[model samples]
Target: MNLIRLVLCVCAVFGTQLAQADATRYPLTIQSCNRDVTFNEAPKHAVSHDINMTHMMLALGLKPHMTGYSGISGWKAVTPQMKVILDGLPELASKYPSVETLLNANVDFFFAGWDYGMRVGGDLTPQTLTPLGINVYELTESCAFVMKRPPASMEDTYNDLRNLGKIFDVQDRANALIAHMQQEISEVQKTLPASKPRVFLYDSGEDRAMTSGRLGIPHALIEAAGGNDILSDIDASWTRINWETVVERNPEVIVIVDYSEVTAEQKQHFLETHPALQSVDAIRHKRFIVIPYVQATPGIDNVLAIQTLAKGFHPQ
Candidate 1:
C-alpha cells in the first residue's frame, strides 16, 4: 500500500515538472530578420504564408492556432495529405494577402518571409502589419534576401522550428522534431560516398536558367546529400543566370524543382534538346533528379529531399 502511494506521488510530481518545462513565459522577444519582435502571449489566431511555411506550422501541430493559410493556390496545389489536414480552414488568399484580408480574419500572428509572401518594401510587411496589432515572424532562410546572412544550412530550418515552438508554447514537440530530423540526416551521412557530385538546380526559364544559390535551402540539401551546388558561390537565392555559365560549370547531375508553373518533363526535354546544353554531362548522361517544390523549400520535407538526392547521386 505504501509503495503504491509513493509511486502515485512521484508520478504526480513528474507530470507537474513536464508541464512546467513546456510552459512559455509571456512577453517573450525573439529575433526575426535581424529585428526583435515580442509576443505578449501565444496567438490564438495565426496565418501562415506559402505552402512550406504552412507545412512547418502544421508539423509542429500549430493548425489549431492557425486561422487559415495563403500563397498556396497561386503557385502550387496543396497535396491531398495537406488538404485533409486543412479541411475546414479557409485559404485567405490565393497569393499574398492584403492587410485588409488579415484584418478581416482577425489574425494576430503571421508566418511569412521576403519573396515567400511579403516582399521587401511591400504594402504587406512587418512594419505595415505591426501597427494593426499583428505580429510577424520571418523564415530564416529568406533572411538572406533582406540582410547579410551566411550560406544556408540545415540549422536554418531547425532555428525556425525552434523559434516557432517557443512562440506557440510547444518547445517539447519542436525539440523532438529537430532531434528526429538530425538523426535522419546523420544516418544519411553515414551511407554517403566520399565523392561529392557537382549538381545544378534548374528552377525554370527558357532563355535563362533560374537556379538556387548558397542562400537557398537547395544548396544545403545538395551538400547534405554528398553533392555540391555548382552555383554555390553566387550571392543570391532563386535568381536567373545565363545558360552560358551553366555550360561553363559542367554539372554532373541536374536537380529539377518540380512545380505547377512548369512540368518537370518539359524542363527535362528542354535541357535534353537545348543546342547549348547538348554536351552538358547531366543532359548527355540523362541524370536528372526531380524534387517537388515543397521538398526543395525549407520545411519538414527537406530531410526527405536529402534522402532522395543522396539515392539519386549514389545509386550503388
Candidate 2:
C-alpha cells in the first residue's frame, strides 16, 4: 500500500504523461534525498556536482555558464579542449562542499552525480535550495533501482545526446559531436574480435573492491570495449565486494580506478602483492588500465573510457 502511494505520488508529480508510454517528451524526476526538478527551458548559472553531469553540460558548451563545481576531481582524463573549459570553474571542493559554501557561490542551478555523496554531505536538496531560486537536476543514470523496463544502453547514448542537445540549445554542436563519436564507435566496433572475456573494475580503495554496476555506464563501457563485467549479476550501480568473489570470478582484464596521486606502480602493487589476486588472469596477462575516476560516470568521459579500455584489452 505504501509502495502504491509512492508510485501514485510520483506519477502525479511527473503528470499523467507516463500514461502515454509511447511519448518521448515527458517529465522525468530523480529522488535524491529530496526530489530535484529539471525544466524544458535553458539553465544559466548552473552548478554541476557530478563530474559526468558536468561533462554533459561541458559538451553542450555550458561550462561558461557553470557557476561552480562541487567535488571537482578528475582533471587529468579531460581532453585538452574540455580541460580548458573546466579550468575556468573554481574548485569548490574535492567532493561536495558545505551548503554554506554552495550558497556563497550564488548558484542558480544544482546538478548532483549520485544521491549518496551529495546527500551524505548535507541537506542540500532542491527543497532547501529552490526557495533561494536555485533549481536542481540529478542524473537519471544514478537512480538506485534495477528498473523493470530496460535501462538506457549504448544506442540510447546517441539519442540522449540529441535530447540533451535540445535542452542545451546546442543542437548543431551535439549533432556534430554525435557524428564524430558514432564514427569512432563504428571503427572500434570492427576491430573487436568475438570473445566474451570477464573483466574486473577495480577502484583504488585498497580495502574492498568498489566497482561498477551490472547495468549502467560501467557495464556499457565494458561491453563496448569488448569485455564482460564480472559483477554484472549485481543489479546495483556501484558495489563493493570481497576478494573471495574477486578470486572466484578471476577476470581476464582489470580496469583500475586511479585517483589522487596514486601512481600506476602503486595500483599494480596492490594487485601483485595480493596472493589471491596474483594468479588471476588479469594479473597473469598484465592486462590493466587505469581509468580516471571522472569517466566512471555517464558523460563525455565515457567515450574516452571506452577508448582507454580498448587499448588495454588489445595492446600492441
Candidate 3:
C-alpha cells in the first residue's frame, strides 16, 4: 500500500509540472520591437535567420518546431557542431529570404532582427509579413535599431530566451537555461580581477572601422568580462567610424570578429600594419583577441565569449 502511495505521489508531482509547462493560453500576445504580436496558437512552422538566431532556436530545442533557417551561408559557414545540431534542416535561402521564398515555404513565424536579416523598412519586415499570416519575433538586441532602448546588457539576452520560452510554451526549458547562464556569469564574475581593460571590437571595415557601440551585444560581453568598450559612447549598435577615432581611443586590447567574410588573422594583420593605428596600444602590444562571430553576437555562445574575453584580457 505504501509503495503504491509513493508511486501516486511521484506521478502527481510530474503531472502538475507538465500542466504548468503547457500553461500558455491561446491568443497569446508578446512584444516584438515595440510592437504587440498576437499568436492565436504556438507557431507550427517557423523560420529563423542568421547564425545567432538559429543558435537561439536550437538551444531552446526548437528544432522540431522549425521548418528551416537562413542568413548563415551567405556570410558565415556553419561550424561542424552547428551542422550536427541542425540535423539536415533545409536552408531556405543562403542569405536573406525574399517574401516569395517565405510565402512558398508556408511558414507561420519568422525569427529575425533589424539589420540581422530584416532591414528597417525593408520588404521582409513584420508589417509586410503580418498581412501574409506570418508572425515575426525581433531580436531584443536589435530593437535599438528601430527604437530608443537602454544600454545593452545580459538581461536583453535573457529576456529573449524568456520570451521565446513563453511563445513556445516551453517556459520550463527557458527558465532553466536562463538560470544556468546566470550562474555561469556569476561564477566568472567572482574570478575576475578589479582592473577593467579598454577594449575595441573590430567587426569588418577597411577605410572606416566597423564596430559595436553601446547598444550592441559586444558591449555587454566586454563589460561582463571586466573590459570597457572604447566606443561605448556611440548610441548606435553596429556602425562605422573613422580609423582616426579608433587611433584616438587607444584601446589596450582589440577584439576581431571572426567570420567567413574576413579571417581573424587577416584583420589582425591589418591592424598591426595600419600606419594610423601603429601608435594604438593594442596594436603596439599585439593584444588581439579573436572571437567567433556567433559568440560575439547574442546567443548561447555569449557565455563562452565572456570567458574567452576574460582570459584574453587578464591572462594568468
Candidate 4:
C-alpha cells in the first residue's frame, strides 16, 4: 500500500511539471546549428563567448543583455561602443571564459561560437549546463565544420540571421539587417567584373602566414565580389602556404590582411622592400588593398571591406 502511494505521488509531481510546461508560452523557437532553443519571451541576459558568435548577437541587437564576452583584449577592430562593453567585462583567457568566471556571472544563457564539447575536457556542454539550469546555443554557421557541412555564403548568412531573428523574436530587425548588407554587397559587386582579378590574401605573419581557403567567409566574400581568391583554389577555410608558392604566383592584386600588429602601411612597405615584389602589378599600380583584421574575416563588416576593395580595384 505504501509503494502504491509513492508511485502515485511521483506521477502527480511529474504531471504538475508537464502542466507547467504546457501552460508556459515561448515566443521564439529557434533551431541553431547545435541545438533547438525556445525563449519564453525575449532574452534579457546574454553572453557571447565566441568571437563570430558575438558578431551575430550584436547584429541581433542583443548587446543590451550581454553579461560577458571573450577575446576582447585590446580589440583592434571592435567599435568604440563595443569597447565600452569590453571594459565592463573581465578579460577572457581565450575564446570562452574560465568556468569559474562564467559561473560567477550567474547568467541564464551562454551563447558560444564553437562547440567545446571535447575541447574543454567535456565540461562546457548543454548536458553539463542542464544541472545549473543554463542553456547553450552554438552558432549555426560555426557548427558547419563539425557537421561535415559546407560553409555558408552571403545567402546562408542571411538565412542564419533569419534563424536568429526567429529566436530573438525580431523578424523585422533581421530582415532590415540582411537587406542592408545585401544592398551594400550589390553595390560592391557591380563595381567588379568577371575579368578575374588575381588576388593574393596576405592574412598572417612570419609566425604563421594565415590564408583563407574554401571554408571561410573571406573566400566567400572574394567569390561573391568577383575577385579570384588565390587561396580558394586550395582547400580549407584558413591554412598556411609556402612563401615560395606565393612568390611564384605573383598575383595582380595583393590584399594584405591586417591580422596582427603590422599596420597597412607596414604591409605596403614590406611589398616595396621585397626584392621579388619590386615589379609586381599590385606594387606598381598600388593595387594592394589593406584590410583590418576583423573586417578581413567574417561578419557584417565584410560588405564594407568589399566596398573598399571595389573602390581600390576599379578606381573609377
* CA-lDDT, candidates in order: 0.88, 0.65, 0.86, 0.62
Q: Write the per-residue lDDT of candidate 1 for residues 147-222, one digit (tens) a residue.
A: 9999999999999999998999988667666666787789999999899888999988989998889999999999
Q: Tens digit of lDDT per residue, candidate 2, span 242-313?
A: 888888988998888765576656987878788778779888878788877666666655767888888777
RMSD of each: 6.8, 10.1, 6.4, 13.0
lDDT string for model 3 (114-153, tens) is: 9899887899999999999999999999999999998889
Residue-level lDDT tens digits of model 4 in 89-173: 5444444465666677776677664432213336666567656766666554455545554754666567666666665666655
Where does the lowest 10-residue lDDT sum fall in candidate 2?
16-25
Off by over 4 Å in 4: 1-29, 34-41, 50-55, 81-96, 115-132, 271-280, 283-286
Q: Rank all candidate structures by their lDDT, best first, as comma-separated numbers.
A: 1, 3, 2, 4
Estimate the TM-score of every prediction: 0.93, 0.77, 0.93, 0.75
Q: Which pairs, if any, clash in model 2?
A: 71-95
List where candidate 3 sits over 4 angstroms from the true fold: 1-22
Off by over 4 Å in 1: 1-22
Model 4 earns a TM-score of 0.75
Error of 4 at 126 (Å): 5.7
Model 2 TM-score (2 dp): 0.77
